[model samples]
Target chain A: MKKISILALACMLAACAHYSLAPEGAHTVQGMSFVSTTDWNKSSLRSGAKSEVWTKDGERLNQLTFIGGIKDGQTIFTSRSKELPMPEFRANMLPNELMELVVTSLKNSSGGELVIDATNLRPQRLQGSIGFRFDMSYYDSNGLARRADCIMVKKDDRLNLIIFSAAGMHYYPKEAAEVDSIFSSLQL
Target chain B: MRLLLSLLLLFASLASVAEGAQRFEPTLPPGYAPDKSTDEGGLWYQVERFEEQLQTSPHIIRNTALTEYLEELVCQLAGDYCGSIRVYLVKNPHFNASMYPNGMMHVHTGLLLRVANADELGAVLGHELAHYLRSHSIDQWRNAKKSLGIAAFIDIGLAALHEDLHGLARDVATVGLMRYNREQESEADAYGVQIIATHGYDPAASVSLWKYIEAERGADKSKDTSSIFFATHPKVENRIARLKQHIKRYGKNPKTDETDLDEFQNLVVAEYEGLMDEQIALQEYEQTAEMIDRHAAIGYPDSLIKFYRAELHRQRKKFGDERAAIDLYRKAATFERTAARSHRELGYLYIKHGLNDAAKDAFESYLEITPNADDREMINFYLETLR
Candidate 1:
């Protein structure tokens, strides 16, 4: 799978990715921007310009996905992979329904059944806008436990989402402070 | 020595019973416990651990009355082995009912929702019980080990060597053995029909049960069966054919008297809305609509069924769905036994179509019913807009 990550990097680069390099500084991605506490690798992996990935050790252990400016009828998962059906994200979807879409995406992308551990839904401020926040723990199909923190809001019939997910054993707690800081620095 | 002799005799007796024949009494002889020193015993111990986890798992449905109802049904079907069997109702939306070596069965809510009547459910319960009666799990474990052509103890010793690795290996094995072979499944089917028939349930219901599954699978195009190793799967087509043959051959007029629709509804109607919610979460709109219609046709609460029908229309949002959704939501909201969310949703649909007076009344009713709803602010905003 690590070999797949290397191949993925080459694939993204050859696919006309928009790359931003910074030594632990602020970054503007699509219509949303955030400051990173650590030097992060940002690339258009799924959808060019509309979606981006930031990771420390690639997506194997820890990663942050930025799914921004998705139109009213667009789906959150932009994977062109035809392996599994994609879950859609509609503008009129309730907060809980949108979260269900996220979990469905996680399961479909991973190609495995998932067991949710905890779900904490709270009203949180996102890019100076009132959005919903979700802190969740779940086990992936590979029996790898993970934690995800996400904030999502809909504006002008478009979805702006930022998700931070990492291995629950050590990586999640280790990088939690940085993720929190980055979330705080978000602007739309 | 006595236990071994008894096991041998029991297996020989079970093997002697022919398919589509009556008078096959399923009796569990004394001394069925495996020695802890054996590899099969190790499997049993692992299964016990799984049972323990299942007992406290959040996915377990703990509704006491429902649990008691299922227990009684299993007891009726199990007969001699009734005391040995245990059933767990899980909240999963897949059509499955699994039995472990330790006589622990996990029946999914999907199975309940799919089965049209008690007799259909009885057929499933009886099939799972038959697996336990015939000791298929132990046989499967032995077969798997043989198929791998590895010494069972070598893997057992490795499992004993590392506790964590053993846990992981157990999980993998559990997933691998989720389904039984075609022969075993066929035998279980035959045995289940006989058992339910003996217990006064219509044996013909088994045919209808598989028909439902076949129809559901036929409608689902996304499920890729190309790579599936269904070598031993009684392939739904063959099973339906064999089941019909068995029903004819058994020839005892396979009692068709009791449908038990009322009892089935009384036990399951309260759970339809919640199970439908799980189905909708997967965003399979067509499948969800089919399920709602099936239940509604068979007389589930009109209020809940209409609400879900409205939700199906609203979420799918086809050209005419929004208008249809408004009508259904309004119908659901007017029902006496409605879900509180129905009125709230009706209010939103009303506001969407710029019907302020109707929207205001719906919002007020929703707030009156659910004062502490989480989306209170959003509902209030709609109400203010309507004002």
Candidate 2:
């Protein structure tokens, strides 16, 4: 009986472990397809059904987040309390407004401890749709300087966003080219 | 002459009673430092390490003039302890000011934005200074250590040693451990009023500050009072009442007391736009609207306030917000001192409303005002399309 219970517990633990190593290949997630140039680990921890996270090292070192098909009136980030202000997506939002939403959401996520500066707002094309791109650099609460490259597009009254963030000292420059390739290969 | 002397004696007696009733006094001597072997010393060492990290934080406002202005004001309030205190103006959009036991003080931009004038600012600084002088943080740390036990206390020390003392660990070491009880808060409040009154500032300004905070909190539909400042400090209404009592007991000439409004405005103008930008990004529309209204009521320039009002409407985008934003933008653009970006925003609104000619004209005005605008290329693209 003890052996049987131990075996059941092992299976339960395995079921709870949802993180998996994602191979370098083309894959579709939430109606968006992208080709990964390198192997990365996928995390089950996500904000909602439309959001997913990937990491090479831990999230603090390097992270890639895909927030896809977010409908209007839905928040880009989930906060701990409903009372806390989080910017909601609106279909008619301009490029700058969209950028503000993302920036504000990131600040709210960090409880105002993250000091971020966003600059170089320009237009780009993603998945054959007109979108906007920007650069963001911030210091985490630990005083680690980090940088992110973000691209966002709106399609069929829904928003799609991709962000690749890493420590600015070494990881960002090291992964820039491969991340740019991956961003270029995205299809929504 | 006899009547005047009697009045002075009466005032002195009342002041003595007020001070005696508080039943607390400053424990730290001038140029005070803790013995390195004690628990207080350990806490100060950890905080000093955090201070080193804070110095390099990008969020710190490095403007020499602005920082010097704040430092001078703090010095005026701190008196003999001025040499020991160091002030860091952090660019956060939350109304908070924290004093570390190690004499590192953080004055958030939000607090600056909220206070009407120098007197209100002085009141807050005096309160924080009182906490430092009373050694409230060390007392609270001892209480926390006793409650949390040796195991958790060791964990805190280990976290500090590993330099992993950030986020939750940092909060535990600093804000969490320094949380004061109600009696301590009342004592601080009493001293804050008395100190400001002594410095020729109106003791009533403290009451006004708390009242404004209460009104701002009420403006939010959810009435979220879970902010770190609100959580750690006494309730706004309770603090206001206690402050009123202190003022009644201590104020020599409350009505005649003057606040340096012009000096405060002049010093803050350089950072006003950046402050507004950070506040607007928070997206707490109701509270921000209330703050802007209160700020305008305090006699800030109409042009700047109008632009932020327009920005609030433009970003929230509720029913009728577009029309409100357009009206405000037009009004703001009429003022010569308004930010040139007002025209850019008006141009975007015109484009949204399908008024291409107006959009073209607005964009041209933007270029005329700010020829070297960073987004000049983007504006030129819009103009080309309109043509």
Candidate 3:
């Protein structure tokens, strides 16, 4: 009976640590609504409004992130106890500046752990609002090349962003279509 | 007041040295290696593991010219012992250099950026080499092991077994790995000047270098100059006087010693820009401004420097900053190799001040210059709004 109770507590703790996001229906995330066409495991994020992870081969090799309703003067990265101050996210920041913010955040938080390269930006329409989309190629700490597709939009004095990323090899190619479908299903 | 205090401390250090301390001799001769069965060999093996890991670290700078220059400078200071020591340049933005037990020295880019010329670089390298020659890490490790053994024994006896205590153990080990006493630091400082004198580099540059560090610390009290070595050493104020004493003892005529300013700038300026970008990203505007002021006064003008200057003003947005940014951006754009985003930033500033015609021109120029920029759609949107 004691062993059973311990097992149940461990299961509960695991569930609390890794939450699942419903994939078959629309979800409102921090005032931004979107529909996920594929199952993704929601997890606590250090930054951004909401975060989810997708694993392959028993490892968390892919991630889907949503940053919604970021207010003016707020930063896109989390504050650390003894870390240097971070740059704030201004509502009027240009797309290039926004890109720099993401790159800088990755570099600063990683302590030069990650190297990122973003390619040309394309026009994207999110819930009928004008937005910009870009693709990035980066190397993680272990020198694993990863690819990501991101969209950024400023709406009603708030910034909403979404990024879907996976390992640059087989995993990214396998999930690329599903990621595009998920982005296509975004709604206001 | 600080200068006076430093002088008094210098006198104190010289007076103390008159206690007739034995001069240190290098224990490890040229091409020395420990036997595999000994404890020193065990330490070397562990350090080899760390060196392997460091080789794969993303922060390791891999520029061939830069690495070669650093190794050459280190070798110049080390002389006969040069063959056994390996130098690794790291990309951390703090002013520090460290030597491991296995003759591996890691020099941070921050230290590289802070030094004005080759002699200053030699001073820092010579100090680190002094630590290596003396094998201070072995002493630190032995002392740490003794304390850790006692702590572990007590903890085990008390049956205070908890998962949290594992982290405590790691913290204790890390702290023990460093924390050399004041005696080791003074020895290293004194011997470091001897190495500089032997190499025909300016020994007084050590004093000047510490003063530069002192001035930087005074400018921004928040900046951490502490490294593995500085964390436990006596205050910089005391060290400055000791370094001055050594300079008086061993310094060559300034005209006879080599600064190698031209070669240092050539090898370091390109990397300096990248390091400065890292600083700008840190949002420590005051530190970056001080760097800009120092470099600009030295006449180190380049497109990247101008762009960052404009970026500094633009980010602050104080009174007249917008106008200053505009002018600085224009100057930066005049350089044929300026960053493409400078025009885009110019467009934003022009639009904010209701200069639609100028905004359009700037946006067009930005698009033309960076036809494949990642933010084309947004720039186009701005262009449409301006039209």
Best by TM-score: 2
Cα lDDT of model 2 by residue, B1-387, tens digit:
999999998996676566646644578987899998998888888788777877786768776677888898899888898988999998678787878898888888889888988888989998989889899888987887788797787676555444532353335534347677776777788888878888788889899988988888899867565566677778888678767878886655444534355778767766788888888877788989999999798878899889999999999889999899999999999998774778989998898899999989998999999888766766776787688
How accurate locally is residue A114 in candidate 2, as Cα lDDT from 0 to 100? 62
DockQ score of the complex predicted as candidate 1: 0.13
Give the CA lDDT, 0 to 100, for residue B378 in model 2: 65
Writing each residue's lDDT as its tens digit, candidate 3 over A72-148 gives 88866674523465566777776766777667666666554244677666566666776767788876655567898
Segments in model 1 whose C-alpha atoms lie over 4 Å from true places: A1-31, A34-65, A71-74, A78-84, A91-100, A103-150, A155-157, A163-185, B1-18, B22-31, B151-178, B222-232, B249-261, B351-361, B384-387
DockQ, each predicted model:
0.13, 0.35, 0.32
Q: Listing candidates in order, what is each one's chain A TM-score?
A: 0.80, 0.86, 0.79
User: All candidates' TM-scores?
Assistant: 0.75, 0.87, 0.84
Residue B332 accuracy (lDDT) in model 1 = 88
Candidate 1 or 2, higher TM-score?
A: 2
Runs off by more than 4 Å, candidate 3: A1-16, A44-60, A112-115, A118-122, A136-138, A141-146, B1-15, B18-24, B150-173, B222-230, B253-259, B316-320, B339-341, B370-378
Among all candidates shown, the one with the greatest DockQ: 2
* Docking quality band of candidate 3, CAPRI definitions: acceptable
